[model samples]
Target: MVRSILIFVITYALFLISGFLFQIDQSWYDALNKPAWTPAGGTIGMIWSILFACIAASITIIDRKAGGLNNLKPAFWIILIVNYLSNQLFSFFQFSQKNLGLATIDCAIVAISAIILTVFALNIRKIAGILLVPYVLWTSFATFLSFMFYSMNL
Candidate 1:
């Protein structure tokens, strides 16, 4: 149980590093012509926090079921790393670079890779895959939001 808790904390912290590194440009973001349905910054942040927890849980489940992280297949590691990198890149593209188009593309990659990761996870552990459902749904929503931002700003 202690090991599982450690895994969750470490994974979640890794996910959050992107947010810390590439914070939202509040002034510029606030000036954008966002859709009426756009969520508040606080709401988005909360949602991400929840989603990251889910992701961490999913990883921990997979790691436990596979005996250990090192025991997991190379393919699983590849997909997981790809998803993590793409997910982190979204903040850089959207906030740091202030490139909505790149952000939109990055979101699409995040969504697609998340689906792949979930599927791969299901093959290893059903509960692990199930834990990722919210992450998948949220990333899909975020992809649409990114596209909206791109189009609205352009």
Candidate 2:
């Protein structure tokens, strides 16, 4: 139980670090020609918060279902870490570097890695996989948004 809580906190914190480390340039982002369907800032934040929480929960569940963190397969760890790194890179590419094209590609990686992670989680536990659905969906949506941002700005 204690381990699960620790895992949840650690995972969520790691995911949240991108926001802190690569602060978004509001002026630049706001000036972009966004689609009418683009989510407002508050809505985007809320969605991310919820998605992060779900991702943390999914990881925790997978860890438990596999018997323990150490028992998790190396392949799972590789995919999970890759997904996390790709996720963090989005903030750097989109905000810090202001490279929408790179951000769009990174988002696609995040979405694809997330789908792979979900499949791995499903092999361990159904609920764990289910928990990641929103993360997968949101990342896929964000990928589209990133592409739109790139094309519109170009």
Identify the leading candidate in terms of lDDT.
2
lDDT of 1: 0.93
Q: Write the per-residue lDDT of candidate 1 for residues 1-154, one digit (tens) a residue.
A: 9999999999999999999999888999999888899999999999999999999999999889988999988888998899999999999999999999999999999999999999998888999999898889999999999999999999
TM-score top scorer: 2
Q: Estimate each model's TM-score.
A: 0.97, 0.98
lDDT of each: 0.93, 0.94
The 10 consecutive residues of candidate 1 with the worst lDDT sum are 72-81
User: Candidate 2: misplaced stretches above 4 Å?
Assistant: none
CA error at residue 25 for candidate 1, angstroms: 1.2
lDDT of model number 2: 0.94
Name the TM-score of candidate 2. 0.98
Query: Model 1 segments beyond 4 Å from truth?
Result: none
Q: Report residue 49 deviation for candidate 1 (angstroms).
A: 0.5
Task: Summarize candidate 2's per-residue lDDT along 1-154 as a digit string, tens digits.
Answer: 9999999999999999999999989999889999999999999999999999999999899888888878998999999999999999999999999999999999999999999999999889999999999999999999999999899999
